[model samples]
Target: MVNNSRTNPSSDTISYLELLQEILNKKNNLLGFAGVGLVLGLLIVFTTPKEYQSSSFILLEPEGNVNSFGQMGTLAGLAGINISQLPTSQMALTSDIFPDVIHSRDFLIEISKEEFEFESKSGQIQTLGDYYFKQRPGNIVKKTINYIISIPGIVSGWFAKSDPLPSILAKSDEDQSDYLKLTSQELIAIGELKKRILLEQKGKLVHLNVEMPEPLIAAKVNTMVLERLIDYVTAYKVGRQQRNVEFIEQRVKETEQKFNEAQMRLASFRDSNQGLISQSARTREEQLQFEFN
Candidate 1:
């Protein structure tokens, strides 16, 4: 009975070994796939394009009434007007108007046509069509295979496919526009050029640091953005001031008209009553003179 048990165990062990050998034999078929995968990965890494970087910095300064108002709290409080309610500090550093100005469609449209030229060799031109069109032919092939494989199954919906190149390019361009739109929409977008932007605020000081893929563009954008911001702020302030001036001028004109009418009425009253009191006094003086004669 012991020998019978031992014989049965030996047969089971042989069956397990045979299964292990079959798996090893199948692994040989996968070796070719693994080699191809490695080569494709290396090609992708080596051929991928690289981007350059550039940057600029801006230091925020207090402007207009905010600056005066802050000083008034410290030095002009004894002059009978309390300016403590005004938020000079907050106003100076406020970013409330920046996002709108930066992201305005007009502003984005202005920079959209700025040139972004890259060099290409004659040899590169020959391969450009193949790189853009044919290199990813497997994408279409895989989609077609998936569609065919699905037949009438539940996965048929997932396998719906179109020509890969046009769809891929369209998607890529759309993504690029989306990215540009985000930047064009806000002054803070300058900081989104990868990790090239830095915002620093210390005490009353605010600094905006922007980095780009080109040096001149970095400087240009930094300068232009700040200048535009200042211009917008100044124009807004001037517009407010002009409106106030108009209101004040209108009030002054109304007050002047009322004053002139009151003055004319008083003068007419004096003119009409001028002789009555004077005539009475003159008659009394004549009677006193006759008595003296």
Candidate 2:
């Protein structure tokens, strides 16, 4: 048998290069591909929605100390109480906790329920919640990519088994709670809110930013959310002070009762004794008289 094992490495390399060159020689095909790419790029640029951000900076100060309540402070001291520490040493709210408050289910639910006149990308004015839940526009590219990526997960979930009994019991228990439990619509609103709103704290300052496709709506939402947060913090401070006021009032009532009883007893003693007096009793009586005077 004749051996024919020798192959030219240079010839194989040249052939591959010739094939690539032939493909490049087809200018019509190359131009068509380029044109398609250009059109897609332009479509993406034009079709993608525009976002407007409206932001505000806030300087958060600690709630004033209870000691600042001039006359109330004095009265508290006289009553042998520290009015300065009546409620708390400082405001309950801080920049660190502000984000948590804003993200809380109750707060988000309140925000979702609020009605704002928002003009959508399509120039139709509607309630903010409605816009978020029912009419929000989608990005074609993003939706397509997400759907493609989630194909595997969707298949797996379809095959997975679920236990109806425990799920039903847990859902019923959740429904019975007074705390804010998000419905499907409310949950969608929350997801949109999270994407649109940003919060950050620096030193003693808090910066809030809200974004939307509509400039007017963006600004309105930003202002409204900030106002809500302020109101929540103020209400907490007022509530603490109210409890302090109630405490002081109760103590005052007790002190008055004791004073009234002592006065009545002294008056009765003087009535029964008439003109009777001894040095020690006389001195005591004079002291009582001085106090009454």
Candidate 3:
């Protein structure tokens, strides 16, 4: 026997019409809450600082014949083909290392020191270090986020023993390599910059994106990074070629010295034994000729 009942307490639930009517009754409360949310959103939007972004393509494509590398990704569209893995006749520095080059400590430090006329609410010329370190001037939202994120570090700092970072200049390392001792200002500036600058490889094109709180700074930094990247790569290529040339020149000089020595020995033997017909002299001439050749 099957038992069917309309009143099942286990599965009791309201219908769609009942739910709609209940929502309608509370519409005034919902509207009030929405109004408050709208006001808060508008306040945050208007008060919060705006970040401007500027982008430029990196010039790393190969030219003429070999233009299909990872950097020169013109021919990488082929299905499941990795050019870097393939054995090629050309050995070159590709765009892969560019990210590392730009993010290098020296490169970042240099960029931090570059003075620019920063325009936010007020206009003033200062280095990137001064602007960010002195006045990262964080908003309420940023402050809350930073506080949350830094809780662990703050707790650790209490237990740990370390010197406070100096405002002007601080040692980067204990053992002293004279390698990029950063100021507290630069430390903050670099931290900010790391977030703002990005290198992305998209198919055949490599691009640089820079973001700043100000419009002009964004554009300026984008241009600066591009110029510096090109310069660094050019210098590396030129230096490699120069070393190769120097090696070849040194080899040529040594060969010339050997040739001259052989010639002199041959000439001296001929001068001393002129017209002296003997197997020893003839054998000696043959030996000298072999050596000279």
Candidate 4:
């Protein structure tokens, strides 16, 4: 039998020197690519609007802390109002559901409808929804890319008259529903908004962040968002407390009915045994007394 073996030891492996030489050989191409990349990066940086961020957060008291309302009581004393003796809300917004309150569509929609002074519009005040629709916030590259990508849809839209989606709030009917139907502009505004705003919770404190093209606008929007969050939290807590009060009242009614039944049973036993003297009557009276007690 004959054996034949073939092998290449340095097959596809490059030495350190050879790799350096190869890179040197393509010096011009690398430099050209680097220059093009730098140019593109610079263009992106220049075309993008500088955003300013404003941040705020609320420090909540410890859960189920009865002493947390001390400050409220103090304030009430100043106003000659005795809320200290009044009932306080037993329910609170928990950390688990806190994020939902911040990111909810209804919460965001309220913020979008708020009017703010725009520097880009020469001090003319406009709602966030309208501004987003009219001034489409994005860098030039994004707008160009979007325009190119949407060419087919835009062309089709030209041939076919398209109607805008209806807003739930804009409806003139007396009917109201739990679900929301956002208009095209509101949807666009919300999309832009979700990008500019952020919310995070650490322990009991919840932080809110808002970013905008202008400094004043960022601060204003941040304040508004915080205010809305506080209002929503207060309303939620109040509603929960009201429900708790109702539950307690129901329990109280049931207890009263049981007490009345016990009293009636005891009274009937005494009346029926008035003329009878028997061990059974004594035993029955004792049983009824035990139950009443």
What do the candidate models score in CA lDDT, each in turn?
A: 0.51, 0.77, 0.75, 0.76
Tens digits of per-residue lDDT, candidate 2, 106-220, equal: 7777777766655544565565566778744456566577679979999999999986668778898868877655687777788788788889987777999998868988898
lDDT of 3 by residue, 220-258 (tens): 989999999899978876765555445445555676688
Give the per-residue lDDT of model 4 (tens digit) for 1-293.
99997765575355766888999999999999999988877878888878899999779766444344455445444434444344553344665666677667887788889888887779998888888888787777788898899899978888996566467645743365765988888888888888888888877777888998789989999998788777877787767655544544555566567768988999998997798889999999999888676
Model 1, position 138, has a per-residue lDDT of: 30
lDDT of 3 at 233: 77
**Model 1: ten consecutive residues of lowest lDDT:** 125-134
TM-score of 1: 0.42
Which residue segments of model 2 deviate by more than 4 Å?
1-48, 116-123, 135-138, 148-177, 266-293
Query: Whole-model lDDT, candidate 2?
Result: 0.77
| Regions of model 4 farther than 4 Å from truth | 1-32, 65-92, 159-176
* lDDT preference between candidates 2 and 3, better one: 2
Which candidate ranks first by lDDT, i.e. highest?
A: 2
TM-score of 2: 0.66
lDDT of 1 at 221: 52
The regions of model 1 sitting more than 4 angstroms off are 1-54, 66-93, 115-203, 209-211, 275-293
By TM-score, how accurate is candidate 3? 0.67
Q: Considering TM-score, where higher is better, how would the candidates rank from best to worst?
A: 4, 3, 2, 1
Q: Which candidate wins on TM-score?
A: 4
Error of 3 at 172 (Å): 14
